[model samples]
Target: MDFRNLWPSLDLIIDAGPIIQNQGNRNGSTIVDLSVKGEYKIVRDGCAKDQTVKILKEFGLKEIHD
Candidate 1:
């Protein structure tokens, strides 16, 4: 029941409810929040830039100066 070891990869999302329940530390931040808020934002925002790389990669648009 190690919640620390229940992170989801980009290739798949595993259900970590049991582990979190057993560990008794449900802050309600599920795997989706972890990936979407943490890793997804990192790749999207470039982590070193002020813009979203995902916008350029997905739509071939340049910097949105707004």
Candidate 2:
């Protein structure tokens, strides 16, 4: 059964309709890794993977992959 109608009343949902439609809430903004010092990871590629890498390198931040 189609569940799109319930989205409006649902408290939480992971529907990808918005994402597929290019209407994401964050517009692909990458998030910073603040758990460690002097290191970083791309939590979300968002819409700026290239830009994120450029800034990370400019600041000499090490990228860690877990």
Q: Give the candidate number with the greatest TM-score.
A: 2
Give the poorly placed runs of model 1, Cα more than 4 Å off: 1-12, 17-24, 31-39, 42-66
**What lDDT would each prediction earn against the true structure?**
0.35, 0.62
Over all chains combined, what TM-score does candidate 2 have?
0.52
lDDT of 2 by residue, 1-66 (tens): 998988797553322233322345346455556456778787877655556677777888889998
Residue 25 lDDT in model 1?
Answer: 39
Q: TM-score for each prediction?
A: 0.18, 0.52
Per-prediction tally of clashes = 0, 0
Q: Any runs in candidate 2 off by more than 4 Å, and if so which?
A: 1-27
> Which residue pairs show backbone clashes in model 2?
none
Model 1 residue 45 lDDT score: 25
Instruction: Identify the candidate with maximal lDDT.
Output: 2
19-45 per-residue lDDT for model 1 (tens digits): 233234333333222333223323232
- Residue 56, candidate 2: alpha-carbon lDDT: 71
